[model samples]
Target: MPKRKADSVLEGVPKLPRDSSIAHHTQADYIEVNSFVTATPCDHCLDSGVPCMIDRSRRYSKCASCTRASRVCKREFYTGREWDLLRRAEDKLSSDIEKNEDELDLLEPELSALQSRLTELY
Candidate 1:
């Protein structure tokens, strides 16, 4: 393929110095942008069923909704795989609880009989 010509608009702009403060500021800006991009909604926003909109101007801050409501912003960002694992664990626990409840129900008559015998002895 033939070489492409550079944009005229960018030709006049001077290259940034490697060790300059401007470069450092640019790095910091990148960090801020990455944080904003990767950040998930806070717990309150998730529970309230609202969109999590973080203020681009503020770094490491609460979502706009939480800020407006004056609520504590607690974030727990979980990946899709992590959420799936958590849900699976919860389902297992729920199944165990149901089994235990059924066992308890089956033992209720026996428990009543034992109590009645104890009462007679008393």
Candidate 2:
């Protein structure tokens, strides 16, 4: 029969203090929640023909329309599968660079030898 306070709903919840008023709903709280709800999708998701919608509850950033793993979302906004893909891509790029460097090293010697032969012939 009595009117319950807005903060009464948060009773027993850890981190948040009890006796806090609904009026205590700060601008920061709204901003934080809004950020969780709205985030930019990653480039992969954009390119994959999937709309990158932010899922606050998703362990991985998944497509809101297809529920598929989204590569366009950031780790903060979306975790799990898509995050793994981003990491793997980074690793592959590093490996490719190393391979290119190795090839260049091999070519350097042959290039020097060719130059030396041309000089001798001249």
Candidate 3:
């Protein structure tokens, strides 16, 4: 028995012509897969009392540590200045709420009196 030529074995296969249009495409033609990742670790790491060593190459919201721990990853972390501002805002809101509660307490009796008067009028 004689060995078959490689060309004869591939003779049954249909060949497609090289696409010149594909060669014309540049890098810009392809969609970028990697997203912009932040260097900072997620809130879970901070809350867990662990160092936030984020692996930016993964391009995931959760860091590798957090992912392994099966925890939710939150990116929001306040700086010292932001925390101070937030505390001030919270104090103001609490004062406003107390004032509103006092005003509501004062108005409750007056409202009851008005409702009683309306009932008598009707």
By lDDT, the best candidate is 1
Tens digits of per-residue lDDT for model 2, 28-104: 24333433433445555455654445445443333443233212333244567778998999999999999999999
Q: How accurate is candidate 2 locally (lDDT)?
A: 0.54
**Compared with the true structure, what per-residue lDDT tens digits does model 3 show for residues 21-113?**
332222112212332334444777566666554443554445545545545667766677888999999999999999999999999999999
Query: What is the lDDT of every predicted structure here?
Result: 0.68, 0.54, 0.60
Candidate 3 structure, TM-score to reference: 0.46
Candidate 1, residues 51-112: lDDT per residue as tens digits?
Answer: 67665666536665554455677887797889999999999999999999999999999999
- Model 3 residue runs over 4 Å out of place are 1-34, 37-59, 63-76
Clashes of 2: 3
Tell me each candidate's TM-score: 0.42, 0.38, 0.46
Any runs in candidate 1 off by more than 4 Å, and if so which?
Answer: 1-76
Candidate 2 matches the true fold with a TM-score of: 0.38
| Backbone clash total, candidate 1 | 0
Better of 2 and 3 by lDDT: 3
- For TM-score, the strongest prediction is 3
Model 2 sits at a Cα RMSD from the real structure of 12.2
